[model samples]
Target: MNEYQKFREQIDEFMQHHPQSPLDEAHRLYFRGLFYYEPSPAYLVMATVTRFSAREPLVEMETSTGDRRRYRRWGRAHFTIDGEAAALTIYANPYEEDFFLPFRDATSGKETYGAGRYLDSHRPGLRQLGEGEIGIDFNWCYNPYCAYNEGYSCPLPPRENWLAIPIRAGEKVFHSSSR
Candidate 1:
């Protein structure tokens, strides 16, 4: 199996049996596994980051539980899909040195999580920075913990990060008959 599929397997194992899983005991029994789009090379990208200056201000992110969380505007990622231009602002957690990328594509509320998906330090694929480019593999994008269980409050993608195009990759909406 490929690395992406292996990653999915690890996630499945965690969600199914880990005590700290977002899924409660009752829900775990009904969860076969998370659904994912077949890995697609098209979504893999090396985006050039435009670092923010001191002039850039911090932004507040709205969460699923209606709470506001603040993050510093770190930089902007500029890349393309099939030669079509696209850009997303990258945020940095005020208390931590990790990057945060919350986004909603055309697939949201349909093929994927209604609130949005996330790509950040919590996952492995996009953590390292190389020069001015950051490797972003949409295949690593995942639904926030809230998607599996409402008990978890996850940050929603900002309006600027909402993509007009569909990104048919990574994790799809979870399905559980028990819900």
Candidate 2:
């Protein structure tokens, strides 16, 4: 199996057997496993980041639990997939040591989480792309805790991060039929 396949298997194993899994006991009993699109090389990229001006305003995003989290528009990463140009704004939360990327694509509400998925990478400290770029592997994207259980609050992706093209990669919708 490929590395991503192995990673997916490990995630399934954890969600199915780990006591600390977001899935409740009842759901775990009937859990089959999360779904995913066939791994696509197009969805993996090394993007060039354009840093935003320091004067950019900090934006507050609402969460599922009616809470707000603050994030600054740190920069934007530009890339293309399948001949379609796409870009996503990277946000920096002052409280965290990582850059946050919450995004939604055409696959949302159909093949993936409706509220979107998240990607995170360690902050390069200089507020610039590490090594002049950052790896953007959509295959590593994942649903938030709220996707498994509603008790957890997850920040919704901002409007700017919505992509017009389907990103046929990463975690798929979790069906809670057994529950």
Clashes of 1: 0
Show model 1 residue runs off by greater than 4 Å: none
Deviation (Å) of 110 in candidate 2? 1.1
Residue by residue across 76-110, what tens digits does model 1's lDDT show?
Answer: 89989767899998888876668988999899999
Q: Number of clashing residue pairs in every model?
A: 0, 0
TM-score, cand. 1 vs. native: 0.93
Q: How accurate is candidate 2 locally (lDDT)?
A: 0.83
Write the residue-wise lDDT of candidate 2 on 1-179 in tens digits.
99878888888899989988999998888987888778887777877888887677779998988999889887888888889888999888865546889999999998899999988773111233385576788877889999999999999998999999998887888887532
- Go through the candidates in order and give the C-alpha RMSD of each one to the true structure: 1.9, 3.4
**Best prediction by TM-score:** 1
**How many residue pairs clash in model 2?**
0
- In TM-score terms, candidate 2 sits at 0.88
